[model samples]
Target: MPIDHKQTYDGNNIFARIVRGEIPSKKVLETEHSLAFHDINPLAAIHVLVIPKGPYVSWEDFSANASDAEIADFVRAVGETARIVGAEPQGYRLLANTGKRAGQEVAHLHVHIFGGQPLGGMLAR
Candidate 1:
């Protein structure tokens, strides 16, 4: 157990709350290992957040601790979310902010699927 692991995987995060059914979210896709839902503050025409059911704070934690089956299920859920949100036709961007500098607000590990229109360039410019 490392300090980063301890700091990153704070189980009481907002997404963790959502995973625990403590916070209501408009779900787009749900599997046994993951949950995909609409973002509260959407940045694109279609913005969905795909999160693993397990407690994790970043992609590193997920890759390090999750089984191959869990990872596959979670990744597949992202694609399913994109299709349900109508991002599968044109194009989509998957975003996972790992740390504070990257604007990762929630401590729970999640991927943001954005599409349905021209997202333009990156870095929020």
Candidate 2:
């Protein structure tokens, strides 16, 4: 999907405020490249959001602009966050909503981690 760059990373979005420490969040993990926090509204017993520290509209933006080390660190944070939440043993779902069609409400690039039960499927077979 083609992302609307104008709508991608709005500084007023909640994520941006959280990243700037302007707003409070139930933070779970923070690394040099990423920040992991409990979603204010969770879809599962264990739902967290892992986002890059820098301004990024979507995964494509991050992948295209960030350095190799930054990308690696961000990905590492997601895995580390899952372990902290104890979702590793039972398995978890890591999802990224890219564009409007994918249901990306927030413009900033973030990965949603959900678990605590069998999530079944999101697509029709």
Model number with the top lDDT = 2
Q: Write the per-residue lDDT of candidate 2 for residues 63-109, one digit (tens) a residue.
A: 99999988999999999999999999999999998887777778889
lDDT string for model 1 (1-125, tens) is 11233364676778888988999999988899999999999988898999999987789888999999899999889888888889999999999987766777777888999998898887775
lDDT of each: 0.86, 0.89
Model 2 misplaced regions, further than 4 Å: 1-8
Clashes of 1: 0
Clashing pairs in 2: none
Off by over 4 Å in 1: 1-8
Estimate the TM-score of every prediction: 0.90, 0.91
